[model samples]
Structure formats: structure tokens, C-alpha cells
Target: MSSIKAIVDQKLILEKMEGKGGWTFARVPKTTANTGKSYGWKNLKGTVDGFKVECSLMPLNKEYWFMPVKAEIRKMVGKQAGDYIQVLLYAEIQELHTPEDFLLCLQDDPQAFEHYRKLPDDEKQKYIDWIFATVDEELQVQRMADAIDRLSRNEKLPKKVLSAGKPA
Candidate 1:
């Protein structure tokens, strides 16, 4: 089930924090986003200065919220840390769906399929989204292959892929 929350629009500076894994994001002031993270992490989909964005609004100390700006999005938008941007966003509870191709790959490897089935929804969603995100078909295939290998071994997903890209 999915539900859309209130919409928000605000100008935010893209800032970076040093200690906490060097996160780069824009703060969504509680004043602006009065409803995004009241329950927990809320998945958001909207636009940042006209560029499409789908992200999670993470709550901090229940005071404010921060939305991470991924490096890929930064490059596409040609914005760097400290740049001000107009953010138009709305939070939603998303329902995760397994991709057919990804499912086919897993079905071939019973152990991997079993592990994937037992994974938390977020973990499963990560793999599904990452595998489908790349426009390059070869990269997508490789991601699926790597995922199955890691899953069958009962290992944490490849850190590189988990973060942004496949490890070189």
C-alpha cells in the first residue's frame, strides 16, 4: 500500500557533513516539511529545480529531515555542495516490486532465490532498483549476476554496488 503525504517546496543549500560518512544533502526544514518523517523514513518522489528526483527523506532527532543528493544526480543537475536549489517534493510510502528479469535470475539459483526471499524489503528494493537503474544492458546483467553470487553466499551486498556503482 502507498500513500502520498503533503507537498513541500523550499530553497535549500546543498551541504556536506564531515563526520557521518561525509554525507552530502539538503536539509528539509521541519517548518517546510511538517509531515514527511513523522512515522519513520518516508520515500519521496518529486523534482529539484525541475529535475526528477526520487529519494528518501530521513529524519534527524525528530527535529528536521535531510534528503541525500546522490553524486549521479549532482552531475546531471550540474550542482555542487553549497549550491542553492529549489526543491519540490512529496513523501510517499512506496510498495516494492520484484522485477521479472531479476526474479528469473534468482529462480535459477535456489540458494540465492531463498536468500532474496528472506531479505528485508529495503534490501530487496535496493537490489531491484540498482539493477534496473543503469541504462546499459550489460551493466544491468552484470549487476544481477553479482547480486546472485553475493546472495547465494549469504554475504552483505557488494559495498560498491550497494552505494552507487559496481566495484571496478
Candidate 2:
């Protein structure tokens, strides 16, 4: 079995995906300038989690800039482009969180608690981590639970609990 290699950094991965629109690696034959003879090959590379990757597209799209492949090849492993053609790099996956998990971390302030409940999963975790790092542990736990309870009751946190503090 072949294993892929990658570097894992949340921020960096996001940045690369944003810049490239997706990830892809390619290999092409090199030609001699004078005789037009094939001199071997050259590879184009990209990454995810710091690992090099190659993928095949489900169907061929010749006009598209990127093509999909059967399997992804990282820097550590090598694969011929024609071996299993049709590769295209797609968008990166983002992490999601559940309401229960979100609630468990919002105990610091009921209003901030409600504010957190309304946020998207990614934003909620970012905020939760920020709050957890700065507030007292006990308060963090309490706020998380309180936020959950408020949701269950279909009620919002009081205005006092929503005040902002120094950055975490």
C-alpha cells in the first residue's frame, strides 16, 4: 500500500487553498531544444497539510486549468501522470461543531453565550477558544452550559453578559 505525506497547519492550508483555488500536481515530458528529443520529465507540485498531493478528475475537462486524478501523490511518493489520468483539485474541507459541543464552552457570559450560539460552527469555536483562553475555567464551563440552556429554552442571554473583554 502507498501512503501520502502532508504537513498539517490549519492557517497555512486555508491560505494555500485560497490562493490556488484548489490543489494539483502535474508531470510533463521535457523536450530537447534542438533535436526535439524527449529528455525525461518534470513535475508540478502543490500541497495540503504540508503533504504533496495528486488527484484525478471524475471526468476529463480539457478546457479547465486543473485536471483530476485517480489518486493524490505527495512529495514523498511519485506517480506517472498518465498512469491513472483525470485529476482535479477541489475545495478544502472545513471543520464543523455541534450545538452540544458549542454549549459546553460558553459559560462565561449568558449574553456572550447567546451571541456564540448564533455564530456559525467555525466562528463559534474560534470565539469559544478565545473566551476559554482568557476567562476563568469555571466561568468558561458555566457559560458554555448556560448558552446551551438558553437555546433549549428558546431564550436569549441578558444584555449584561454580552460585553466584550480584552483579546485572548
Best by TM-score: 1
List per-prediction Cα lDDT, in the order shown: 0.81, 0.38
Candidate 1 regions exceeding 4 Å error are 1-91
RMSD to the native, candidate 2? 15.9
Model 1's C-alpha root-mean-square deviation from the true structure amounts to: 10.7
Shift in Å, residue 16, candidate 2: 17
Best by lDDT: 1
- Scored against the true structure, residue 153 in model 1 reaches a CA lDDT of 92
Clashes of each: 0, 33
Candidate 2: list runs displaced more than 4 Å: 1-85, 88-114, 134-168
- Residue lDDT tens for model 2, 79-167: 43223222222333345444454544454456656655566554455445544554576666666665555545555444445555222
The per-residue C-alpha lDDT of model 2 at residue 82 equals: 26
Q: Write the per-residue lDDT of candidate 1 for residues 35-73, one digit (tens) a residue.
A: 522557667788887899988887765567888988878
TM-score of 2: 0.27
User: Residue 125 deviation, candidate 1, in Å?
Assistant: 1.1
